[model samples]
Target: MSRPFLKMNGLGNDFVVVEARSKPFAPSAEDVRAIADRERGVGCDQLVSIEPSARADAAVRFWNADGEEVGACGNASRCVGWLLMEASGRDEAVIETRAGLLKATRAGERRVSVDMGEPGLRWDQIPLAEEMDTKGIELQVGPIDAPHLHTPGCVSMGNPHVVFFVPDAEAAPVREVGPLIEHHPLFPEGVNVGFAQIKARDRIRLRVWERGAGLTRACGTGACAALVAAARRGLTDRKATLELDGGELVIEWREADGHVIMTGPAEVDFTGTLP
Candidate 1:
């Protein structure tokens, strides 16, 4: 049987979205991997499914290329939100995920602003291996006297993230050091690694090594986490623009509601049926 699917992207973080609202479509880990394969199947960073929801407009799930199902994916959420709005002819859409319920609103032409919810600042909320100051955890890479990366700020934007403030994001050894920190014992559930370079009080350059997807052009939650971590460290303002490899995202940690807002663009690549 063939299943209809949508090929979409937020920034450059792409996804293959399968709708399961009317029919149950659950793909196993191996099935997800096969469909996400670059050559054999429709390639994507993550595979998304839109299912029925009672508490919200829809229920969504995310699976990385490695076939690991995750709680939330910022970029994928935007694409889903867009799909919902386009289908129902509404300006706003709500989605339920493993992370929690999220709201998405159209932000100008071809852009979406998603309320990512409050970041988890506590040690247990981030659920690290043990307790540590989230503002600047006690971890590093390289020599003790002079480590290449150290004292990173941790935050949970529906997912665990460790952000290291580097002088140059482009110069950071993402491929070399990303995997080491991802599977490190400190993060019990694994972690997304962000190498951020603060360009100004309102701008940042970021590169992320996704927990299960490796390095990619963009990471939505990674961008949100970077802004939160940067603000906690006093390196940048509470609201800033994160320039990712694919594009840029505007993130704001609202003081009043304490919710994080991530604004960016989502695009359609092409659509086809999966055999």
Candidate 2:
């Protein structure tokens, strides 16, 4: 038998969303990889499953293309939130995840805004191997005397991330250095790597190497992490527009409530069925 699914993308970070409320859909690591394979099956950066939830409108799960289950995905949450609102004819929806409950609302037209909750700045929360200054931790790459990348700010927006401030995001060696830092011994659970160029107090150019997914067009949580890291380091304001390869995302770290709001577009590419 086959199952109905939706192909969705947020800033070109695409996903294959499966509604499993009626019937449970549990795919193993191999199954996840196969479904994410561009040549053989439905291709996506991550696989999203929406199931019944008692605490929120629905419960969502995320699996990377490499097949590892993760706590949260900001882009997927926005996409799922849009789906729920459209189905219920409501403006807001709450989606639960392993990370926590996320609240999303329709920002405009095809845009959605999600409250990604407060970021985790403590080293233990980011779960670094040992306690250290999250603002530019002790790590480096390339020549010892003149490292290519070093002292990146760390933060956890549902997942781990390390942001490296660069003079030029486009020129940064994301592909070469991303994997090296992702598997760095300091981050016990691994981490997403972000290269950010501060364009202004309110703007930034960003790129991310997502954990397990490698390089994606955009990474919602990575954007949030970058903003928080920047603000903590006094590099940018609490709110900034992050320009990604696929598009742009507006991120606001609200001071009053200590919640990070992310607004972006979600597109329904097409609908299909699982083989």
Candidate 3:
């Protein structure tokens, strides 16, 4: 039987979303690989499944292009939220995920704002291999005397992340270094890597290497993590506009609630049926 699906994107981070509430869609790792393959299947950074939920509007799950199941995906959440609101003709949508409950609201036009919840600051919270200061971990690359990258602040916005504040984000070696840090011994679980260059107290230029999805045009959680990491390092304010490869996302680490709010645009690229 053919299953209908939606092709969506949030700041060029694309996804193939299937509504599985009624039919119960469960794709195995191989199945996911076939669907996410750019040359042979529908191209996307990840695959999102929207399922039935008793606690919220829907329950969402994510799988990377490598067919690895992940706990959270901020960009996909926004896309799913936009779809939910559009279908219900409502301004808000609540969602459940492996990470936790998340709420999405219409910001303006195609823009969406998601409450990413408080960041995990502690070493154990981030679940590092050993106890240490997450603000700047003692990991380095290149020569010992003068390492290329060092002291990355780690945070968990549902998923683990490590942000390296750099003098130039554009010049950062993302593909070369991202995979290395992602599998570093310090992070028991693989980590998403981000390189950030502070433009101002309110602006930052960033690039991210997602744990399972590799380098993408944008990553919502990565943006949030970068802002929080920057704030923790006193490099930037509590909020900033993160300029990613695809576009910009405004991220705020709210002091009152400590909930990170991410605002960005979502779009419908097309639709197709899974054969």
Candidate 4:
């Protein structure tokens, strides 16, 4: 049997979107690995499946290129919102996920604005093994005596993340310390590592080392996490522009709603049939 799929990219973090509303198929790790293979398959950072929702909108399931299931994916959610709007002829949706429900609306022809809900900041919510006094904790990336980086604020946007504010995004040792901080002992389930360079109070540059997925072009959740971590530490304002490798995302932690609103573009690269 052949299944139709859409190739989409949310600020360069590409995804393979599959609609599983009618016919059901559970994608395995091997299946995801094959489909995400750059040379052999469609090649994407994540695979997104759209299923029937218990709420008014649809439900989304996110799978990494490695085929591991994830609690949430901000990019994939916007892509799913795009698909739902196209199929149902609606301009808005309230999609559901393991993390929580999100409200998505059409910002422009190709852009979607999503209310990503409140971020979790408590050490328990971030789910570190032990409690730390301050939101930021010191984790040695290289050597015990002299480490590469230390004292990163931890935040959870459905997934765990550690943000390191640096003087320069280019100079930050992402290649050397990303892998180390990703598997730091404090994070039992591991974490996404972000290096952020604040360009201004409202603009910042970011690079991420995702947990299941390595250094992707961009990570929406990682961007939100970075803004939250920075705002809490007084490094940046409540709202900021997160300039990622692929493109830029406008993120606002609204004081009125206390929900993080992420506005960005989602593109359909192509469509293919799964055989």
Candidate 5:
């Protein structure tokens, strides 16, 4: 039987969200690939499923376009949060995921703020093949004498991320080097690769090659990871505006509670029935 679904986007990082609170919706890898196919199906960066939760408002699952189930997706969480709040007529919503419980609140018109929780800075937390300094791991690409990208800060915002600070984000070879670093041996479980250019103490430009999703217009967790990594490296302040290709996200690594708060816009493109 066909199912109703919502098409939503946060900063242009789009998703196909299915409400499974009443019925279980488990799609196989092939099914997810077909659903996310650009030519034959409703194309999206990820497919999100919202299910009933005993502890939180709902439980959310994320699957990349490549059909791999992942731990978390910040943009999808915000979108789902908005859906829950609208349905319940409440200002705040809690959504559970493999990463953990996330709380989102209405920030403004069509805007939502999510508490992404604390970042994992340890090597084992990032889960590299070997323990190393997370501030700047020993990974490099391009010619050995003159590497194009090197010494990236590592952090885990639910999922593993590596942030490479470059002089110019546009000049960085994201498409060319992204896949290489994603599959690097150092990252046993693979990782999201981010190319960031620090615009100022409170601003940054970022592009991300999401694990199993390739390069997306925006990556919410990537933005949070970038801010945390930048702050740890003393490159930027704890709070910064991350400018992505699709739009901008405000990320703040709160010191008191050590939680990362991400504020951004969520849009509903349309609603339809899944074939």
Candidate 6:
């Protein structure tokens, strides 16, 4: 059976969006892998499916390139929001993910704003193996004689992230330490590792090593997690612009509702039909 799919990107983190709102299509692990195969299939960093939500909006299911279902996906949410608006003709909509409900709005010609909800800061919230403050946790990786990176802030944006604030993100060992930190013992569940460089009070640079997927162009939740980590440490303002490898994202930790609002662009690359 052939199915229609949309190729979209949020700051270059691409996705294959399948609209299954009318009926749920639960793709198996193998099926998901097949669909995300670069050469043999519809290829994407993630596969997003939109389904009917009990909360009066829509539910988005995310699968990584490895075919594992994930709790949250920021870029995918924007793509889902765009698809929902285009189909329903509404400027605003709510999307339900495994993490929680996210409010989104069509902010520009090809941009969408999503309220990513509140961030989780507790040790258990981040689900680390042992209890330690989210502010800083001791997890080292690299050479046993000379560890490269240590003491990172662990936070959750509906998913686990380990952020290491450095002086220069570009110089930091993203490729060297990212994979090690991601599989470190502290994180029972593998984590998305980020090397964050604070450029100014409201601007930062980031490079991410995703859990299920390796280094990607960008990661929205990773960016949000980084900003929250910085804000809690009094390092950055509540609102800042995150410069990722792929593009930029505006993140605001609203004092009123404690919700983290992520505003960025979502572009449709192309549409494909399943064979």
- TM for every model, in the order presented, reads 0.99, 0.99, 0.99, 0.96, 0.99, 0.96
Model 5 has an lDDT value of: 0.96
lDDT of 2: 0.96
Q: Cα lDDT of all candidates, in order?
A: 0.95, 0.96, 0.95, 0.87, 0.96, 0.89
TM-score of 3: 0.99
Candidate that beats the other on TM-score, 5 or 6, i.e. the better one:
5
**lDDT tens digits, residue span 1-275, model 5:** 99999999998999999989999999999999999998999999999999999999999999999999999899999999999999999999999999999999999998999999999999999989999999999998889999888999999999999999999999989999999999999999899999999999999999999999999999999999999999998899999999999999999999899999999999999999999
lDDT of 4: 0.87
Model 5 — which ten-residue stretch has the worst lDDT?
Answer: 140-149
Candidate 2 clashes between residue pairs 3 or more apart in a chain or in different chains: none
Question: What tens digits encode model 1's per-residue C-alpha lDDT throughout 1-275?
Answer: 79999999998899999999999998999999999999998999999999999999999999999999999899999999988989988999999999999999999887899999999999999879999999999999999999999999999988999999999999999999999999999999999999999999999999999999999999999999999999988889999999999999999999999999999998999999998
Point out where model 1 deviates above 4 Å: none
In terms of lDDT, the poorest run of 10 residues in model 4 is 133-142
> Per-prediction count of colliding residue pairs?
0, 0, 0, 0, 0, 0
Over the stretch 1-275, how does candidate 6's per-residue lDDT look in tens digits? 77888999999999988879776678999888898898999888999888888895888899999989999999889878877787789999899888988989998987889999999999998889998988988776667778667678888999999999888888988787787777878888889999999999999899999988889899999999999999988889999999998899999999999999999988899998867
List pairs with backbone clashes in candidate 3. Answer: none
Colliding pairs, model 1: none
Candidate 6 Cα deviation (angstroms), residue 233: 1.1
Q: Candidate 5 clash total?
A: 0
Residue pairs with colliding backbones in model 6 are: none
Tell me how far the alpha carbon of residue 188 in candidate 3 is from the true structure, in angstroms, after superposition.
Answer: 1.4
